[model samples]
Target: MGGSTPTFGFPRELRILSSREYRHVFDSACFKVHGKGLLALACPNDVGHVRVGLVFSKKNARRAVDRNLLKRLTRESIRLQQHRLPAVDIVVLSRRGVLELDRQTLARQLHGMWRRLEKDVKRAADAKTSA
Candidate 1:
């Protein structure tokens, strides 16, 4: 476990309800990369802070307990790498394998996904600046 409390965690930080704010992101969000257990979607938001929407659908991960656990692990991974990410709303969609993966595997998968997203975000930002 991390020594310091993680800033990007559930109840305290994640956003998951269906609303107009979410719809705004849904239409604009672009998906960058996907791995066995995860898919990352990025959307530019008007808010100053980055918001996360984590989904572990019942159709994929059956048990509520298992789904919650996977969400928590993904949350921690994001919290640790929060500094490297851009200021965009990120949604991580979870798969069944996510529940079974080891901590290292989970971290590595998420980190790789984050890295991909960062690259795309930066490239787009640069294109806008150059244009």
Candidate 2:
């Protein structure tokens, strides 16, 4: 067995902590990618690392369990694709139909959203540098 297996976890540095940080992302997201069950918003950050925030409003997902499940799925998706993500704060919002979707569908949607988020961040950064 490997003595020191490479660890993979969502560290605090990679999470959008604090109410102010969440408010900032909610109030001023530069770009977004819309999916059937989710909406991902992205904005460049000075932290120089990709940070993720999950938002599952009670209005959208009624049950507490459902909300928690959505949060888990979102975090797992980010963990898997964090390497390909850029230095931006991404907030994922769950839609009304999110609970109805199966795990595979949710994963697929998350994957697509992540890809779009990456492209949007790159495009925005390029535009800023050019201007």
Candidate 3:
């Protein structure tokens, strides 16, 4: 297996780690995408790569297993779609009903959310440049 493959790994730099980083994205989020099971917030970043943060709160899923499952689904979806996503900081917040959904359903929803968010980010970026 080659290490140069973009799809082969989810690197640390591509993740939104630390409370400060998460707070920055949340406080400065430029656009938001709301899906049935998730809410995605996007903020432009100069890092030249897409970064994602997942928030599966206790209120979203009471059980630890359910929270873990939702986080896994969110992370997997983001990892697979990282290339397609815009160069922005994105935070995905899982909603209460997410735990009851199947993996396929959740993946589809997350993918759709990313696609829409990407478009919004691109539009915002374009507008900023044009202005």
Candidate 4:
């Protein structure tokens, strides 16, 4: 164990716990990225790293298995891409037809959304610097 590998773990600090945190993002999201059946709303955070929350309602997923699958996919995607994301609190919402999508499709959609968010954050930063 001479060389250490970089870890990409989803710790509690990387999660958006509590209804109040979710509400804050829903109410004041500065960036929004929409995908096939997923939407990611994000707002800048002072914690200096990205945080994620999932909102997969029963009306959308319909079954506990389906909901858990969606959460797993979403969380895996976030864990892999968290290093590239800006310091923001992100809430990912699933639409009614999300379960219809295959796992690969859903993963691709999430990846695209994360890329869009990164671009948006960069654009905002450039604007602020130029101003």
Candidate 5:
């Protein structure tokens, strides 16, 4: 390589790794952003950056390919939008209709969800500060 290249890698530190971590977010979700075929629950974390967990259950997507595709899209969306997100652990759950959506539609939906999530977090912060 001639010049230094930008690394667009999704590192392990940015993932909600263990069952305990997932349970914490589930039990005490600070906020949720709903989108077509998906629901994202998030709780504030002290990690100083956003971390993501994806739940594409077999009940929702019967095919392994469909589940994997959704997971990849979710992870890529999070990686791109991480800097704009608050310090929170987010778990994105897929619904039954998710597999019906085409890739582009799904990507757009994920993008919108991230935008909504950012807005919601900012609003909460503002409310906290004003109180």
Candidate 6:
């Protein structure tokens, strides 16, 4: 994590509640994309900042540790990219193949996902505004 907190992080009191929202970030919450392994839910924080959620399931990663590690990877990646994204909630789904990815590859993929998501969000906003 940066010396400064990423633009989006759940407040200490809200992290658990955020995960309980159930809606996927892409479909429900506003979002931006990064790489294959990384997806984010973006919603304006109450103070107009971003918040994040990480999802890793045993069905996808197999082991509890693997799932936990995947969540950790997602957290790190988002923390690194948080400054560039707007306020929104993000939920990263862990595909089965994610366990096969090395750390560096995962990080790279996360960055790419973020770039794609930014473009998608902008395009959607533009479309909505134009409509």
Highest lDDT model number:
4
lDDT of 1 by residue, 1-131 (tens): 78686554445444545666567666778655687778877787665555677778997789898788778778887777776777788877876576677778987898898888888888988998999
Which runs in model 1 stand beyond 4 Å of their true positions? 1-18
lDDT of 1 at 121: 83
Cα misplacement distance, residue 23 of candidate 4 (Å): 1.1
> How close is every model to the real structure, measured as TM-score?
0.80, 0.89, 0.90, 0.95, 0.93, 0.72
Measured by TM-score, how close is model 5 to the native structure? Answer: 0.93
- Mark the 10 consecutive residues where model 4 has the least summed lDDT: 1-10
Pairs of residues clashing in candidate 1: none
What shift in Å separates residue 76 of candidate 1 from its native position after superposition? 0.7
Error of 4 at 17 (Å): 0.3
Candidate 6 Cα RMSD (Å)? 4.3
For model 6 the local lDDT of residue 98 reads 82
Shift in Å, residue 20, candidate 5: 0.5
lDDT of 4: 0.94
Candidate 3 per-residue lDDT over residues 11-129, each given as its tens digit: 89989999999999999999899988789988888999889898888898888988888887788888888888888998989876777778888888888888888788778778889
lDDT of each: 0.74, 0.87, 0.85, 0.94, 0.92, 0.65
**Lowest-lDDT window of 10 residues in candidate 6?**
10-19
Off by over 4 Å in 6: 1-16, 24-47
- Candidate 6 has an lDDT of 0.65
Stretches of model 2 off by over 4 angstroms after superposition: 1-7
True lDDT of residue 20, candidate 2: 95
Among these predictions, the greatest TM-score belongs to: 4
Candidate 3 least-lDDT 10 residues = 2-11
Clashing pairs in 5: none
Clashes of each: 0, 0, 0, 0, 0, 16
Q: Candidate 1 at 20: error in angstroms? A: 2.5
Candidate closer to the true structure by TM-score (higher is better), 2 or 3? 3
